[model samples]
Target: MPRSRSWLPLLALLLLPLLSAIATAADDTRPNILFLFTDDQAPWALNASGYDQAHTPVLDSLVKEGVYLTNAFTVTPVCSPSRASLMTSQYGSELGITDWLHPQREPEAGLKPGTLTWAKVLQDAGYRTGLVGKWHLGLTDAMHPTKFGYDYFMGFRGGGNSPKNPTLEKNGETKKFEGLTPDILTNHALEFLNVDSDKPFCLSVHYRAPHAAWLPVADEDWAPFKDLDPMIPNPDYPKLNVDRVKKMTREYLASVASVDRNVGRILNLLKEKNLDDNTIVIFSSDHGYNMGHNGIWHKGNGHWVLTENPPFTKNIPKGQRPNMYDNSIRVPTMIRWPGVVQAGSTIDKTVSNLDWFPTLLEMAGAELPADAKIHGNSFVPLLKGDDAKWDNDFYAEYSTKHQSHTHMRMIRTSEWKLIRDFLNEGRDELYHLTEDPAEANNLIASNSPEVQSVIKQLDAKILANMQAINDPVLKEAKAKSSN
Candidate 1:
């Protein structure tokens, strides 16, 4: 061979290793993910979404700096099922976790040990995973966060506890904190962020706020809404007692305000550490809440006070039905990714908590297992301002047959929403959302052909979704109908 040919071979050998190193570094430059989850936060609770009653200055600022999803929803309105769906990217029916995981009754009900979560996937892809707040999925050793993927878990294992001076569990050890729950959790999350690690990190900071027993928030947090009579849904609904509604609203908003303050603290830490640019921050809730909306308080199977007295009475009648109303399922969702996701962008298309699984995995450059059956489509294209085709419909299921609520399934589109109570002898609810966004009117009794056609269409969609998820309730309902 000639000298020129030998020189060419040597240059190729040297450049090949350098090129491989560059490729490896580029692939490892995945963004760190910070997910901020709240409990019982309604879609309209944020000031950015037009609820001025809420003093969420930090979240509002995030809305301006991120993509606000106007129609985001949870697969189930309850905590465990919704959180399970978020982690597994599947419906609650598919996971057989239709109700909140209770410690005494269903201690073993949780994501299976071998289940694939976005966190686990990211961890497999070389990301550090940590959870610093509420983990309602399970309490058993086999169902623990560490059993699944998280390298660090420091939070409560049950549904919820008092926001003040609560006990927390960390790596098989339990300890009590002296400060507020949100503040303490935020401090732990900040500590997780400060952990010296070269690998990218994924931290989930779930807060128990604005849930039931909504008292004892710091006085400063309650000061903003204490004197203000926050707005209630469907004020004209005769069954609703406006006084009780106003009081609950004040307490709920105060809790939300506390959460907002802590959110600001987290955001400030990211900026202080100069991690804002490379961090993908998300803010959302487990599900929505109803503060006297459609004559209900709390979530699934919500009750209302019948009389204006010191001792309140629940107005539930025999065979009473709970509902999956918009106020109970729709949640405020926003995402901030510095250069990839456009700032101040709002997506009106319907999206679900399930979508987060696939979106985060895609963003982290993680591969989905071949056997993994994910029900959510990745919305990363939408975040990138691409002309992506998106789903316009949503499906939600809530099964509390063992609780006070009846089993409910819902299908909603842009213009219409249909809610079916499988166990209730009462009529289903059909609303034309364009004409009535508040969902105050039910057109289920209408005999008009157009109304019937829409109901039929939505009912078919619900059945199809049920079949897709192998819903046992649907099978039972079908058996009953056949008989």
Candidate 2:
């Protein structure tokens, strides 16, 4: 009996080791996800996007090695709503986050409790998830990144942070990090990658660089732009402040250069850890930026960068030029999936920030919860370069409650764009996008029957989108139109 019992124990020990090995093997098959995001990055701000003045070598390399999405855009061009859409695949208006969360004015505003994010989905599906940098969604305990399914979070919970010596939250405590902000964030990202485990991980590195206050970068980043006068997107607009635009352009490009430098660090780390092949790297911005584009300097809620300004209207302030310009909504986006996606591939299909949720879930082999309500489709097939039927039409919305006032909704196609300002009368705009890529011409006043017919069809599409979301402004907009 004792001899037989000893053999049984030996067999049990051998089986335990084998089972553990099998489990680890299964986990290793799942790819690690590294999502690198930036703040206020314009699509043309990259060298890869043909802006030769922009020094984004690392990013350009990523584009060469992966898939560059030429027409990527965000649902809302502001920080909070775009982040919300990226996280949950829901529009900003639906989540009641139509504007950037102002820390002082809107203390209680945030992503509601129990909101299911893609991070949570991946966490629930056995992947260790983390978000590093810029969670502008909420500033309270209930809306913390951990609450949104991030196993670890290290960044500011507000709209802005200093580019140098930023006070960031880390490991349940706020710590002031020394050095340029981009470098500091990347250092921490490297630490996260150094983990010695077989568990699949999903990490988001959201850089606050290139947002604003774009200075104090490392000398290496600034050297290229130092004493270099950068070209303004529109230097000839009336009273355009060419000098001011040039100064800001130099500063902005320097800020973008800082981000590119840090990205190089992250990519090197991935290769060093031998995780390059097994990891999927994605790069994008919260939304596109505008530096003197259409004579505007900021995003969705744009500000006129002019020596003289437009007069104050019923809804718009004197300096504010609230708009739905393509540059404000379009973002720079790329994805590097080694084995799955072919190198140097380019996808011109229109995709929005909303698509990231379902796309990431599908990549992770995770399923969306039965009750999950999302407004985006998975773009996995597009990434794989499949000949899948795709839609180039999309809708965008922005309601600037703080800086300005307007319920702006847009319907954009390859040929035309229609923007309706529901709060203000006669502020509608229509552009033939193919002929007028700069959107310098507003044909909203045209009485041509052809133009009117196109507007009618596009207006119907916008209303349909609003109705589907049960947009809160729909009733008021309808009433105002009728009056």
Candidate 3:
């Protein structure tokens, strides 16, 4: 027995390699997700991501290495509500955040406090989560991203970080932590990726680039850094839009180009860590903006209006109007997941922000609560090269503070689009998108029987989502029209 003590040590050494082999197997089985989001970015900017406008060799490499979702949209235009809706897989009103209610309004008082969220669901499914960059969902301490299930938070809580924005970069890095704010966010994101933890992670890196203060050079707009500037204002832009004097279309483009460079930064990080295959990179915006596209500077909703900015703000006549337009509602979205998602794949089908929360779950094989109601259908099927039928439509409503009086609703199908202004005695219009991507014609009053039939189908589709918003807005609006 005394001689056997030497043999016991030999057996312990033999079992250590077996344990190490099991750990390696586990690492190979789990996938990681990197959510690359930018503020006020457009789908067109991605060409720089790798399609070649600015030679975003890294972003292009990601696209070449992964899949990109071609058509994607957000639930609302304003900041907080859009993010809230994106997290919960529901529209603003359904989630009880019917306005840009964070910095400006603060979330509604008596409502469901903690419905399931994207971060919460992923954490529950065992993912290590980190939220860096713009975290404007809720300014309240209780609503911080950490409360929503993120393990680490390195972003500003208020809306944005433009030098013009007061709350920009108070804490993340400056003496507290100083540097270019967007660059700070990107650098932190790289640090998060560099983390070599065993738990799978989700880095919600929301870059504040291309949103505003459209500065190109990192240090210029803030002083001691002017060479970082990239864009100038478009002087004759309004003549191009026909409504208001243009402000800064050229500057807007420059802002976008700057964001593209940051996008390349994120893509490059993924590769540097050798995590490209397991990470899912997505790019989109809160909603559309105006860079003289429709004779406006920025937007919160006004169609058919004579000016871009607010009336008193920019001196426009009372009751100047806006018709529901594509530039505002239709935006670009890209998704890239190597091997799992098709490379350079563009479904061109209409989808909404409500779908993002669930799609992430599907990617990680996580479970959604059976009782939870998710308005967005998973495009995971689309990304996987499966032709599973999707609703192929979107219903968007933004009767919020900026255009609250408008009470607008929109429904778009594969080939047709309809818009109804509920407040205007239910005035309705339809357009053949194939013939008019700009929605220049209102086919509602047309006597053509063929157009009426198409209108009817669009109406049915609208009714389905109206039921989602609440059957009454549509029922009451439609009833008002009939009378």
Candidate 4:
């Protein structure tokens, strides 16, 4: 062979590895993200979370095959605000969404355009993003999910919807889907996943089940709980309606099972598509629910589930029990990262919905804008089981303007929790969480020096957190106190 020809073969040998690496790099799409979110799902709603009565086989399996976050919570325990915090990594107050948005009441209210969501970051980084199911943040066209980084959105922009044969928006058209709502939502989600694309994708499947009107579930979904007697959290509480609680429990678990079934379908599809290995599956809820827990039955703006509710107080209507209960804040959260997170692992560190924004950005290897401001730290290290510094202290706020009028701010540590209702006098509460995880004992008025000391410390921290965020409630509270 000529010298040139001989060198060509050697050169080809040297370039082969480089060419192969390039091909691999091109084919290595970033991990697809499947965020399955539920509405009004309590942290203990799943059997995997040790609630034996609940049938959530799919989610239980995910917990076994992934990292179960035992202390995952949302900053705000309402629909709109919690979701806003998840999208922006900022508190609901910071985003002007302190409560669930009412389409008629706040017709102009919606997520502000230009908000930097992790989805937008991922989308900018070449990932296809879609949101299916609920988008309660805003109702206007300007507040559409697509405006907040979703490439495609097929769900209601409002807070509530029927459980079956519901009307949902798809491809800019509001059409009625005939079937169980969860099944219908999952059907569209599967369609989103079936799209032929090489780009990585992020799909948020937000279910409105397990919320209210929790009925008319599929026969299979309802079969397990229909006739079964379920346990109530606290049947001995004053005026507690045991029968009502059990009935709601059965219905709620059935609704949750519907979500579980749909989740199974999604998982199966991911495996069938060979995307499971490369996809990150996260299951969580907008916020936790309370079904007769502490005699309350709702989310942040909870309602008294008593046979006879307390009389109407100033600003608080009859039956309304606005609160910052753990049952309303803590959520059932698990993430299955095929290779990164170890199977059957658990993280007890406190993480909030706010953290997801930065965690996902980091997960996608996407960068935030220089001017973006977020209030959450990335828990990616925790996900990887790395020994990293993690603060277990959590701060949360809820300013209910619709069902009730109150400014409830909370500071919770591993050992203690304090909730101060700034707007409602004598409504403050303090709990030694280490001793009373149920928050049954109200220690705010305790005479003990230790209890008082904790109250002072936690109250100060809550104020500091509010000040850090320039919470409007602080100014309002100050004015009210002076007046």
Leading candidate by TM-score? 2
Between candidates 1 and 3, name the one with more favorable TM-score: 1
List model 4 lDDT by residue over 365-443, tens digit each: 8888899999899999999889999999999999999978998999999999999988888999988889899998998
Candidates' C-alpha lDDT: 0.85, 0.92, 0.65, 0.90
TM-score of 1: 0.92
Clashes of each: 0, 0, 22, 0
Q: What is the per-residue lDDT of model 1 for residues 1-483, given as tens digits with 9 covering 90 to 100?
A: 534566888899999999987866785578989999999999788888788778999999889999999989998988999999999998888888888888888877887788888888888888899998888888888888887789999999899798899899876899888988888888898999988776888999999887766777878898998799778767877656888888888888999999999999889999999889999999999999888777777776566643532332143354233668788888889999998888999988888999998999988988888888899999898888888888789988988744554668899999999988787655489999999888888999999999999999999999899888888988889888999
Model 3, TM vs. native: 0.80
Candidate 1 lDDT at 30 equals 83
Off by over 4 Å in 2: 1-21, 481-483
Q: Roughly what TM-score does model 2 have, to 2 decimal places?
A: 0.96
Worst 10 residues of 2 by lDDT: 1-10
Q: TM-scores of all models? A: 0.92, 0.96, 0.80, 0.94
Give the per-residue lDDT digits (tens) of candidate 2, residues 253-320: 99999999999999998998899999999999988888899998988989999999989987888999
Which of 1 and 4 is the better model by TM-score?
4
- Model 3 segments beyond 4 Å from truth? 1-28, 46-61, 102-112, 163-177, 219-247, 297-324, 469-483
Candidate 1, residue 355: CA error in Å? Answer: 0.8
**Ranking by TM-score, best first?**
2, 4, 1, 3
